[model samples]
Target chain A: MTKITFKDAAGAARTVEAQDGSTVMETAIRNAVPGIEAECGGACACATCHVYVDDAWTEIVGKPSQMEEDMLDFAFEVRPSSRLSCQIKVAPNLDGLVVTTPAKQG
Target chain B: MTESIETDVAIIGAGPAGLFAVFELGLLDIKCHLIDILGKPGGQCSELYPEKPIYDIPGFPEVSAQGLVENLIKQIQPFNPVFHMGEMVERVESLGDAEHPKFRVTTDAGTEVTARCVLIAAGGGSFMPKKPPIPGIDAYEGRSVFYAVRKVEQFRGRRVTIVGGGDSALDWVLNLHPVAERITLIHRRDAFRAAPHSVNAMRELVAAGAMDFILGQVSGLKGEGGQLSALTLRKESGESVDIACDDMLPFFGLTMKLGPIADWGLNLHENLIPADTEKFETSTPGIFAIGDIITYPGKLKLILSGFHEGALAAQKIHRYVYPDKRLVFQYTTSSTSLQKKLGVG
Candidate 1:
């Protein structure tokens, strides 16, 4: 099990187990953490799973596709560091990954 | 004189369409920016469940909902796109014309972002589960009643009664049959609202004495010490009955709210933006809509359909951004170009 920390909209830190091959978004929703609503069901058709991926993981994280980028246009507070956590699966190297939820629950 | 970062395209909502956009646009070498309100991408699938198995999405055989997001995000990682989170788009600004409209994205926090293009992948809206308006309903959330269940393991050996009649309700009944000690399916009316096949299967199971069913309306709930105890029901004959159970599951329908975007007033009908179904463009120029949020000219709200619409919109955006690319390249890679540039090599 991989250890993943979720910083909810309230800045609450939640440590959860993310088994290998699981996305960070799954960890958050499974734990019932607030502010991480994946409204599109992982199809990347919705921007509800928006999160600020710690820039330090950029190498392990890589980048979003044109489709994901286009979907971000409809989100609330998109930033240079914003990433769809569902797009990123947890790897052994990402043991201590940190992700923050947007304050809004759209 | 300025080395400031400039964004070419900005996509909203990091669901399938958004993730695939990165794949499509990255092929064309068009850098873009991405944004979404949830802390993770994949919209409803990831937001709701990562462990829950899904059978509908194409190209997969019983894939976990979370599994799809991981693959999609990986597929689009080749293209580096910008990301924003915890932000709601307040408004979109224009640069006076469609050719060079400076897209100003304002957030609820008053932060502003500028991009050339914006894609609305916000999905079907924020879904709030609709429950039976029984007496003291809110008192049972997380105790006797639940808006959703992410873990089926929690209900092991527990007697669970599920309300409502839909795909989720029937599906949950089927999933929980082996896990729970006893399963009871409830609905408001005698006719089920779930898919015909699902309903048929459920009927078969109940008739064979595998599950229990009550054709009535929920009237009240009785619980103890933060744990669900029993359910009060009004039978179809107008008589009231009480059933003792360990848990109550209300598989009622979900209510989707478009959120603040609904206020934009894109000439909507029945909570959807009406547009040319093929174009996916909203009534207003420089502003488009897709996914379940759009309706017009015989349209069905489905995730795969949104993918097609989003691709079409991106191609249209590409054409709009490079209206003369065809004309410019008419003499570059075409037979005419070979004749003019290389003299028929």
Candidate 2:
């Protein structure tokens, strides 16, 4: 199991334990963390699952794919660390994976 | 890696146009597979206003959206189209050449579909439910709170507090009244945005003391582990009502945007795919678009227009899929081959 912390737009932190193969967005939706609308339900089509990986964990979470970047173009307040949570699959080593949701999803 | 399904044509939307396209294509011996975001095939007709009457459809003077979808489903029954319901087509890429182009379509659920051609009949994009902004409301989702009624038996003997002024909320209140131990409906105001028939029925139920109706907003939730024990409703008069309920259903309705379709590299005009009226093919050759998703000169986003487009698109698709074979246009009413395909012979 991989433990991850999702800091919502309001700065309220929600931590949840997810299986190794589950995406961070899946963990947020499973835990009912706000700010991650996930309207397309992790299709990477709707950028509602937009998230900004914590600076410390940016390298660990890696970068968004070209398709994810295209989807993120519609997201609000996209940052250099911004990534679609659905694209970030949870792994065991990333126990402290921390990401912040945008104030509003696109 | 994901499982893949291969087909002659992969229609994107399961709406009227897409469903009709199946019949049109199937008549020409082209098999199709469909994918829709909603759990069912009816699209907005069934999702938004299943009971609302639509008059513009040909032949039928007036028919409800759901009724039309049902009839279309029956019309295409002989086609035996496969539907990937509750899945959104996320990625679409072109393979092969322009003369014999094929598509690799993938949904959010990791379902891959390879097709000789693609039809974007995604009427007005995916229908996304509007969620209420009750603080910590997400905590109760999937367990105590729901936007769509996936099952009615889940609320059996449970206290259900439905929140909304629309038809969906009022409709559920009436439907679940008999099964639920207690039903409390809370809206921002006494006025409702639902149909008068539904509104009158709900008012009758409240007047008969069968259920409780309150004019208020859901202030917050009181629960743990996604299970709610009660809800805090703030009335217009600045009074709070601690409604004791096990489940809270919010039917705020839905808003449609060109979600995900924007990423497929198709040239979009005002969020609609620009297609030629003759073939309904978009800028991407072999990637045909119909229904409300396409925009052309003098184009009408009506079911009738989509039906016409689907017929024309099928003709063009036949030539694309079988370039060496000569194409012949035949009316279904007069053609024996078409009747045999429908099993009506």
Candidate 3:
């Protein structure tokens, strides 16, 4: 099982096992993590499920789609490393990725 | 990770979107924690315009927005959705073993909770508009400043100013004509943005002298201690005029936008979430966008579309989150059967 570590804005960390085919957001939501709103219900529309992709895995995580780029404009506290948690689909290759959820959600 | 509270699902907003989601989850026998900022469950239907009649919603010939919401709640009764109102969510966290897991949620009131999945269904409300900036207008809210009026039945026999260019503005003019001694319309634009028939009706009222157009914008509000007596208007040519009235209804359309969600930069096209319509997934992984909030190629943001989005997103989520569930959308309807029923086979 792949392991994904989720960190909150307050620096609290919780790790969940990323099943073979599920994305990190799915794993986190199924686990009931605090700090990830996922308002769009995983769609990029609501950036409630915001996180900083483990920098080590940036190159592996391809760029977001144009629609995501547009949606991110509506998110809070955008940063160079800011990524919507819904966008990152998990695969066997991503074994020990770290991610963080944003505190505020609309 | 060490200490966690668990729930099947945690929903926010309790609006049409959130409520519908709970109903969908109930079909799978999943439990939920539904939260809303309002004191009641119907979201805007119960809070914003409880008495206002609504058209364009499918299924019911016609009903008040409140009535429709109530009906929906009753129709989805099989779901047995739980309710938590007057609460706001501030955080989300995840925990558990790989196969079976749990999630934790924190609220603004400092309550820590958990859920397996989070669904946000906050409907079309972000912020409500306040009184437009008018000269000397700061003092007369209780005496004159009203955010919204539920029933216009009592406004008869009073002087009124309806300051908007939308459908409600026009409707108000018609609704209040019989009762108001004087009705004036003050708009920022020369043309009305409301439906053509409503606009025409208001124009007919103007021609009939039931209402008059002031041809300017309200600049300020001026009144004595607690009584509103006059309005300050700014003309297109920088002129100011004062009009006397007992009530003012600014019909200028309100602007809507996403709130704190805008803080996180997700790939967006227009204000809608750019998602793969087929998958109902956004640029963000693990997160799926649904309803009117998502738009992509050949997509429309309507209630129908949102319904489809919610249903589709759930399927995708179920598969992504519950690999063991192994669900699929199998249907019995076929083109051949449809053709045979129509005698086209």
Interface RMSD of each: 12.8, 11.4, 11.7
N/CA/C clash count, model 3: 69
Per-residue alpha-carbon lDDT of model 3 for B1-345, expressed as tens digits?
123345666766676666676655555446666766566787655654566666666775678867877876875566566676665555555464434445566665566667655555555534344345454555676456655565676576778888776677777877778778988887754666568898898888888876788777676776677566878887766788999988887643332345433433446666667777666655544345565556678876455566666666666556545658856443324555333433445
Model 3 iRMSD vs. native? 11.7
**What's the ranking of the predictions by lDDT, best on top?**
2, 1, 3
Q: Fraction of true inter-chain Cα contacts (below 8 Å) kept per model?
A: 0.00, 0.00, 0.00
Weakest lDDT window of 10 consecutive positions for candidate 3 chain B = B252-261
Assess each prediction's global lDDT (C-alpha) against the native: 0.70, 0.85, 0.64
Q: Which stretches of candidate 3 lie over 4 Å from their true place?
A: A1-106, B1-5, B52-58, B92-105, B128-257, B264-266, B328-345
Docking class for candidate 2: incorrect
- The segments of candidate 1 whose C-alpha lies over 4 angstroms from its true place after superposition are A1-106, B1-5, B126-255, B327-345
lDDT tens per residue, model 1, A14-67: 888887887878888888867788865566655678888777876677787765
Candidate 3 chain A lDDT trough over 10 residues, lowest sum: A70-79
Once superposed on the true structure, which residue ranges of model 2 sit more than 4 Å away at CA? A1-106, B131-215, B218-234, B239-251
Q: What's the CA error at residue B77 for candidate 2, in Å?
A: 1.4
Per-residue CA lDDT of model 1 for B1-345, tens digit only, reads: 112345656676777777777655554445667666666777766765567787767777688868887888876665656666555566666653656545666655455666666667676764455555566777778876886787999899999998766677888988888899989987755555467898888888889998898876667788877677888887767788998888887764443567766765458787677767555667656566677667777676665777778766766566555556542222224555334323343
